[model samples]
Target: MKILVIRRDNIGDLVLTTPLFRALRQRFPEARIDAFVNSYNAPVLAGHPDVDQVHEYTKGKHRKGFSPGWLERLGQMWRLRKEHYDHVVIATPGVHPRQIRFARFLNPAHITAFVPPGWKMFGVDQPVEYLGKDRHHLLMTYRILLPFGIEGDPPAPRIAFTPPAHSPGEAPVIAIHVSARKPSSRWPEERYAELMRALHERHGARFRLFWAPGAENDARHPGDDGRAARILASAAGLPVEAVATNELEGLIAGIAACDAIVCSDGGAMHLAAAMGKPVVCFFGESEAHLWHPWDVPHRLLQPESHDVADVTVDEALAAFDALRQEANAA
Candidate 1:
């Protein structure tokens, strides 16, 4: 049997979907599993062992209404139709009409999607209801496959990536990712520098900064490189090294090398979790309960005012300390 898992969303969402692929592979060991993902997030699934193929849907200049991109999308759909997939699973939060239409276009023998309460949709072979209360997003993705008799504890997100060459002997390396597409989710630069200084003094930890280019397009302040420069300047004479990666694959490799990570609620945090590294995350606009690092030793610091900037340096330090303690205990 062949299966197609559709999760054309952000990097973090795709990361959370890894376990579903594993569960499917475990249940049907011989089945071929293909993933349809957004081009930007394709790297997250590039080397996943459970996935047989990774198909990318690029939304570029042709993405506007009635453009050349629609033809490309249609052409891709035509190719997918020829695959004769046995099942197609839409692994997203809610029932997206566009995705639903795409699922129908594939004409798979079985169509399964996550639907919300009171949602009535036609053509879905199995409609899984999303449990929003006290459920992690990773488990939510696994719920979609429950009808297929995939029972047992869901696997955590896993990635197979070569770690970049970096060594900090006898000193723990903490990675700091200072970029968030949402301005409200970014903690202040001064606070980040202060936290770095505090961690360095307390644990003699080495700091490695990770940032993606073009991050300033959506950020309120400067992008990742700019933020890294500012933090280094503010906390002068500190053992902080700025690591810049042009691609998601490079960022994943860098994060895989870290002992722990301090990041906002975004793709970097999710990447760290997939690497099985402890994390201390700052949450502002995003829901901490649903999006926090999954099944990893971690601490979350959220601002009372719902702005990441309101999360103080001391609070972040405390969370980092707790994360260190948890990591040590484990």
Candidate 2:
């Protein structure tokens, strides 16, 4: 049997779908398992062991980089139509009519997707009931796999990257990601710097600061260049290195190297979880229970105001300290 897992979503959504890849490989060990991912999140599956191949295409919005403008994606879809996949799993939660229509265009023999309870999808050969938004997103995503008789306790999403070996006696390296798309999720720059100093003084920890690389005013991909700059200046005389990453791969590699990570709720937090690093994540207006780092010893520093800026530096430090204890005990 041949299978294709379609997860053309954001970086974190694709990361969470990784467990589906592993489950597919285990259930059908001899079957070929491929992925349909966009260029933005393709790097997450770059070297995954269970994934046989990745069909990558560029999305239209990020047109500055490559040929994902329009005609190219159509041509890519034409190629997929020729592959004749036995099963195509649309790895997304809830109803996505656009993606469902695209799945029909692929002309796969079978499609597994989540449909609304009373709605009918035209080409969905196997439909999983989307009860409601109650469980973690990963658990909701796993519903797409029930047709294959694989159920219960999906494995932690697997990332096929290794951290560079470090000396046991060296101070632990904590990664800080200052980029968050939502204003509610962003912690103040001075607070991040102060938290860094506190962590260093308390645990002798070095820091690697990671952020999206672009001007803050860039409307296409508004980055935290100014925030990163201010934080670095505020936390001078400390061992903090700003990791410049123009792509998702660079961010993933930087996170893989860290002993732990501090970031607001976004792709970086999910990447940290995939890397198996302890996390002290800030959850603001987003759904805290639905999106917390999965199967990891971590703390979510979400204040009553639902703004990360309201979470104090001392609160962040204490959260990380508690996480460290939990991680060590585990």
- lDDT scores for all predictions? 0.84, 0.89
TM-score of 2: 0.97
Instruction: Report how far off residue 264 is in candidate 2 (Å).
Output: 0.5
Per-residue lDDT tens digits for candidate 1, residues 246-320, read: 778888888887888999899999989988888888888887878999988888888788788888888888888
RMSD of 2: 1.3
Model 2 lDDT tens row, 1-330: 889899998998998999999998999999999999989999999899999999988777776765446788789889998899999898889788898888889899999998888777899989998987788988989878999999999999778778858987788999999888888998887888898999899899999999878898988878878888988999999999999999888888888989999999998898889888899998889998789999888999899999888998888989999998897788
State which candidate has the highest lDDT: 2
Tell me how candidate 2 scores on lDDT.
0.89
User: Which residue pairs of candidate 2 clash?
Assistant: none
In order of appearance, the predictions have TM-scores of 0.90, 0.97
Mark the regions of model 1 whose C-alpha exceeds 4 Å error after superposition: 61-67, 116-120, 131-134, 163-169, 215-222
Which residue pairs collide, candidate 1? Answer: none
